[model samples]
Target: MTGFEFIAKAFKASYTDIAKRLNMTPSAIADWASGRRPIPKDKLPLVSKLFRIDEEYFKKKELTEVEKIKIEINYLERLSKRDTEQIPDTYTDDEGNQHETYFWYNPHEGELRYKYEELAYEELVLRIKRILTHDFALDMEYQRTRNHFHVVKELTELLDQDDGTVGIMEFEDISKEEAQRRRNLADRVNSISRMLYFLNGGKLHAFGKIDEFDEELFKLLRKFKIIDTKLPKKLKELDDPFDHRL
Candidate 1:
């Protein structure tokens, strides 16, 4: 039997009587009775004690397959939230050194600065997807003025070298295979960035119109069977102003 059914049978109380006794609205009681609402944890103990029912009666039952899947999806969303959180303005390192990080947000001027040093390629891709789905996704002012493309460009530069160097600055060395894996990831990110740039109406250099970058991205998309495989036709239709820099 459902928890609410058990509660009613044990207490010999109508839904309205239970609502009045618990200081809750009758609709809430009805919701519980219909299994439209799960019993609040704090109310569980009161339910058990007042009705002299076993606490186990109110305990959550084994989840169905669909319920299990929902729980798993919620857990994965929580994990993603941790990674996609905006970088704080300032933070202290484990070594006790304090550092000020750049995290600008000026809606009036249409600007947003995002720090991406700690983000992995997978997380970055997710962030790009979220950005694309934002209410301001098609806003030309927000798209062109925002620092999103700048941050993505920086990430591409970081993936270029074996030592994770951006410019002349070097970091710890990684294996050749690992370096190539990063390059491949960077290529994916670069492809997404280019797509965004085009969608945002950015102008492109004439000679830079159809380059290796577009060819690579086009091939990648075709392999994944996402959009149309024909690059030139798609570009011509969009009046494709490709910006290879981003």
Candidate 2:
């Protein structure tokens, strides 16, 4: 976990909360998390004091396979405990853009208010973050499992030996359970790759890159994902409200 994540979860605070407490902008917090830039020297002390964490505690490090799996499982549990809401569509503008102001038939009011109000909509922001975090944790697990089985396969090839005797032995000496487990892991990696590709509109960029997280693009992807994952089920419910088989 990054320092930013640790602070947020431990404090039960949003990004804005951390930013306000540290006298920094929320985008700057996002940047630090994404590694667009490191924490400024001037602010590092304040952050350390605020979180009561030393440099060793906040330093960036790779998570182990067990840590990755734990993150994925914990997020999965959070996902299962939470319920999803189906939001109605926003209205379209004359310029073919969607706006909440269309609901009031006053685009000016919405335009003036949405930017500020959306920032303060803490629950909505948390919900979006929750889904994104879970998906990312799954991707991390897939990468971990793929690397493990790949090394296993490579090492197993070196075990091939030339012998004068013609006795038959199980080739490569991989246990039946291990072979089945490798196959299953491989299948999981493929399925996860495909799911991420489909959900992100096939952009197919690498995850966990040390680049800036474009907030606009993140919001766009979130909208696309919500529509993809929630719309079909919502439509099915509307068609048959009594059907309990989600």
Candidate 3:
């Protein structure tokens, strides 16, 4: 975990909550977590005080895998800045006319966002950093597991909301075919999760019923983590009807 993550965990707060307290954007917190941005000097004292730890606590820790990749990208950016390594600014268009253009590519999303103007060197560096750490190979698997976990969480809450007035139809937006597809996927995922849980000595699945699968389902959902595992846990604890579905 990063210092920012440790702080949020220790304080029982979300990134948005920490951002509000520190007067920074949530993306800034993500940058800190991703190691694209270091902790600001001005905020070190406050951070140390809040977490009841010394500044060196965060500094002395070994870099995580993500941070190591960020450091490599930063080093490569410096190397690419040499005078002999500059790229051209103009390209031949289909009309056979040379025109100025800039390109910024995000390998993770396979996207390029740019304007018909000069681009800042910082933009290229940022894109390279994203490309290096995107982990695209596992993106689909993670998203699929996350979707199943979401259904488990949402259905758990939905059971509590069925006071006989509201029907399940109110929350669905997809066609019946799509809904069946999702249901089949969810059943398969949930079955696999329960099997894993049973092997791991989790007793909640022994009950063998959907309504009784809450605790075991929560544990299984914990394994389907995304960028922030804590966020899902926090979302599960919320009581507001408007915020109950994850």
Give the TM-score of each candidate.
0.26, 0.26, 0.24
Q: After superposition, how far is residue 146 of candidate 1 from its true place, in Å?
A: 17
**Candidate 1 Cα misplacement greater than 4 A, ranges:** 1-120, 124-165, 169-172, 204-209, 212-246
Model 2 clash tally, residue pairs: 0
Select the stronger candidate by lDDT from 2 and 3. Answer: 3
lDDT (0 to 1) per candidate: 0.52, 0.47, 0.48
lDDT of 1 by residue, 149-224 (tens): 6656755554442432343221325447535755675566556567545434333343276776765555455446
Q: Note the clash tally of each candidate.
A: 0, 0, 0
Q: Each candidate's root-mean-square deviation in Å?
A: 17.7, 26.3, 23.0
- Looking at model 2, residue 170 earns an lDDT score of 23
Candidate 1: residue 9 Cα off by (Å): 58
lDDT of 2 at 184: 65
Q: Write the residue-wise lDDT of candidate 2 on 18-110 in tens digits.
A: 789988899988777655677787887887777555544344544433333333334333443453334455788789998653221321222
